[model samples]
Target: MANKTLVPQAKAGLNKFKMEAAKEVGVNLTDGYNGDLTSRQNGSVGGQMVKKMVEQYENNL
Candidate 1:
C-alpha cells in the first residue's frame, strides 16, 4: 500500500503535536513551511516526538 496517514482527519492535531515536540527538543519550528531546517534538526524533532509517544503509551500500559 502507498504510505499515508491512517487518520487523515487528525493532520491538524498531529501538526500541533509536532510543534510541541520540536519545542520540547529545542528545535526551532514555524508554521506554513519549514524546508529551511537541517535534516538533523528535523530528525531530532521526529525522534523526540516518537520517544514521547512511546513513553506515554508505556505509562498507560
Candidate 2:
C-alpha cells in the first residue's frame, strides 16, 4: 500500500505544522504556493519545524 501512492494522508498535518512553524518564526506562508520566500526565510521555517519536533521527542522521553 505504501508504494502505490506518493502522498500520504499526513500531508495536511505536515502543512499545518509548517504554517505554524513559519508563523512562530515570523515567516509568511500561503496555503497553496510559497515560491516568493527567500532561501533564508524558507530555511528558517524548516529549521523551526525540526527544532520543535526534536523538543517534542525529548519531552516524550
Candidate 3:
C-alpha cells in the first residue's frame, strides 16, 4: 500500500513552506527536483522547519 497525507489538499502549501525553510537555513533548494542535496544539508532544512513549526505552535497556544 502507498502512504498518503492526512490532508492532501495542503501538499502544495507544505512544499512552499519547505522551500522557504531551506532558504532561511542557507540551503540552496530549487523547484521541481532536489535529489542531489547532501544528507546533512537536507537534514538541516528539515530541522529548521520543525523548529519553526514548534515555535509557531507554542506562540499560538
Per-residue lDDT tens digits for candidate 1, residues 1-61, read 9968789998899989999999998988999789999999999999989999999999999
Steric clash count of candidate 3? 0
Candidate 2, 12-37: lDDT as tens digits: 88889999999999999999788999
| Lowest summed lDDT window (length 10), candidate 1 | 3-12
lDDT of 3 by residue, 1-61 (tens): 6767679999889889999999999999998678999999999999999999999999999
Q: How do the candidates rank by lDDT, highest first?
A: 1, 3, 2
Misplaced by over 4 Å in model 1 are: 1-3
The CA lDDT at 29 in model 1 is: 99
Collision pairs in model 3: none
| Candidate maximizing TM-score | 3
What is the lDDT of every predicted structure here?
Answer: 0.93, 0.92, 0.93
N/CA/C clash count, model 2: 0
